[model samples]
Target: MSDDQAPSTENGGGGDVETVEKSEDHKKLVDFGLDTTVADELEKLFQAKLVTYDDLDPRALEAIRDFPIECAIAVLKQLLADSNLQHVNNKSAYICGVMKTYRQKQSLGEDKPAVTNGPDEKKLKEILDRTGYALEITTGQRKYGGPPPSWDGGPPGNGHECFVGRIPKTVYEDDLIPVFEKFGTIWDLRLMMNPMQGCNRGYAFVTFTTAEAAREAAKQLNNYEIKPNKKLQVNVSIANVRLFVGNIPKNKSREDILEEFKKLTEGLREVIVYAFPDDPKKKNRGFAFLEYDTHKSASGAKRKLASGRIRVWGSEIIVDWADPQDEPDEETMAKVKVLYVRNLRSNVTEEELKKIFEPFGEIERVKKVKDYGFVHYKERDSTLSALEAMNGYKLHEVEINVTLAKPANENKARERRMRRERDNNMNMGYDDYYSSYPPASFGPPPPMMRGRIARGGMRGRGGMMRPPAPMDYYDDYSGYGQGYGYDDYSSYGGCYEDFSAEYSPHPVTPQPPHRGRGRGGHHAPAPVAWTSNAAAAWPPWYAQRSGGYGTAWRGQSWHQ
Candidate 1:
């Protein structure tokens, strides 16, 4: 049979042997040759079939932490393509291949199979079918934690990682790469240089072929040291580039692209290559965009000759070129009609009100009523949502009412008129009250007739002579002060009370008995008399003499 059809001794058998040996005698049936021979043999075996293993090199396997399991398997399949290399150990080959593939994928992008069930496709299919493999992706700065986008297939580009700082281009290409390359190949490097300020903004974008390489680079060189500088702050970065790559290869290959790129530039700092999903099989159509650190690199690439065709993996490859496009102009915020609300619940705050309407659209601003007024969203959508959601809503046991807010000018005018009317009414009512009332009036009566004057032509006998005792003696005497020695001024004959009137009457206020007095006889109050001009005739000591002695003096002075 031909060498191709011949069954070599390597397949668990010694074929065409002159004598048959016992099982123990041919314990090691396949004699492993030198490293090179073994490698070649392994390549031949792999061309026929692929091998798999669970255990792999820690560093190599970890290099593709974010890479899909199928990618790891594809890489291993490539490493074991030679029959002689089969004895290199499945685990070791897996680890080494994983690391290599990760680095390659970063700079070159993933590879797609040229034929159905080809070497790349076969390995990917095996890995996908293989069980018990998991992947994790992470990004961002070493100082602050980064955000890694989770993806289903092989790890996507590191473009989505959060970047907080920047570094110089020379530092990135010369000082940074040497340190980071130890972990894995750097597919791309981007250091945004602001036009206004030429210095680094303290951030960069890095891409790796395999998620494993990206992770190792991120871990090892994330805070790694660099000459003339303390350390290189490397991490997966967000896609700041205006352009991106799509349609990567399915085999998760990257080296072919890197090798092809080495011809163009002497020292390409980095290139970001990533896969855009077409299917679960990872069959890339073989085209991806390259991102450079500066616009100069992009420009240089644009100016460079194409040689009329692009080549990748020994096959003609298509290239998608990206030119920096101008950013779109910003639109101004629109002014909208707003309704002011009032009598909102006291607990309401601007943030709470904003959260209520955020689902509708972007809210430009929100103002909570400082005086328990309902909150206002800057946009109309939020206002509509609030009205729909909260109209007649019960808050603090009080139902709220929504209404259009009045203009400030109109409100101030209304308040002014109301205050003026209130003041005028108060003044008018006060004046009318005083006008409706009048002062009190009083007048004296006509003069009275004398006591003896006759009513008709003749006077009565008693009236003619002296008045006899009055019929109502007790009453007449009591009216004048009967208890004292009183003279009847009426009987004495006078129109008015005589100048020598006997007594003056006074009302007696009842007095309480003296509890401490033992068997005391109560004295009857004496009548008080008022003669004509008695008050004017009082002695000068009247302010001091005020008892029985004063009365006696008055009587004695009248006699004098």
Candidate 2:
């Protein structure tokens, strides 16, 4: 045959003259035996524009830790299976941590058990009578001696925690805690660690019992020298307890949606889905909200989801903070006497909680449920007094969260929306971020109707497909949270052609009767005329003005 059909045999005597060239990736794919080629794909995605390590770093880890090469390869394979470079910001560094954890556990012979931090852990714990922190080597996030067993008041409120940056990698809590405790009870101190280097990632968060303490820390600690020349940068952090989730399946039900999220991560306290109003089948508008019990839990879940370690329906979903609702009106919070307190030390008694707050206000009663409890004050002033004094108050060494108690469905999002509308401030959309369902008074879904509109026929910017209320009373409503007026923007056929996830609902103009129809003398209102000034009245947060359907704002389709 011609040389074109030549066989490879560089090592042989004239049997074949050519040999297959094996690249590093080629050797890895054979040795790791993973089902995915994500690393290879990432290499291609970045290409010559950026350099990335697509090959395994297990050898370096094995070389340093004396861990078996086989185990290191095994860990590398698992990490690579779901490894999208977009998710793992630093693949090589992340692998280093995994190998370290595996080595520690394998040596202890506890294939899987609680974190035994070994030598470093032992030394940290030895410094105190009782070690309060736990360790997880796999993530390279370990806690040294933990928070004290208990504090005197409730957990801190928003802004009770502050960020500390520009840290030296070698610093630990032992060298930092004593200096900071002068401001208030230290609720939590977290130093981000890099397991590969056995050092910190150079930042930490210090949470105290009160916002005052946190602000004080930020004020006094800013640019304060922690080491010889390493000054710290501190800023009080706002607590974020909710996360925005996008690109979910439009066909999911409330129960179905919750189940999907519950399977992927924890601290999924609530899920909110926007449903298509006009569709009798009640499919969602394809986005939802997830609320967590604690900022820590929310942050953890965000990392897992954002890291691309989790997927919905076999597809990646979007994760970010929902538009922030302003802090609940101080006036509204000031009007209540009942206090909702959470994050109490698990075993603390109700009597103890009541007693802690009693000094600030006369207690009406105390209701305890698991780690959260409620304190009722005899008067509004007492309630306000207790909220200010006890919020972020530490009790039994556990920092508690104390705030005005709210009934189910009355979340901060709705409150802010209402306040914003009352001030005639700007165009406002209903942000039911805190509730999966609307207020109790929102009632049930109204009956569906064609040809007839409800007494409250509301019209909006052209082309928004709203759930149609009955033409008097023709079709019964079929879903929870679907009965509210003008909640979300879900376009249907013949409606807006340029809808986007970034789109928000606009103001509604009541439909006026233009012609007398059958029964009740109700008249069909004329279609609303879109105006240029309508967008000017939009809430300040909306970066783009509405120009009706087919209109482009900031390079995005408005209603479509």
Candidate 2 lDDT over 290-364, as tens digits, reads: 766566776788788888677788777766553222232234445556666655455778888877888886786
| Candidate 1 ranges with C-alpha deviation above 4 Å | 1-40, 43-159, 162-230, 235-560
TM-score between candidate 1 and the true structure: 0.17
Residue 550 in candidate 2, Cα distance off native in Å = 37
What lDDT does each candidate get? 0.32, 0.46
Q: Please, what are the lDDT tens digits per residue for candidate 1 over residues 328-362? A: 11111122223333334557676765675466556
Error of 2 at 224 (Å): 3.2
Q: In model 2, where do residues sit more than 4 Å from their true spots?
A: 1-127, 130-142, 145-160, 194-199, 209-212, 227-230, 239-241, 247-260, 273-285, 294-560
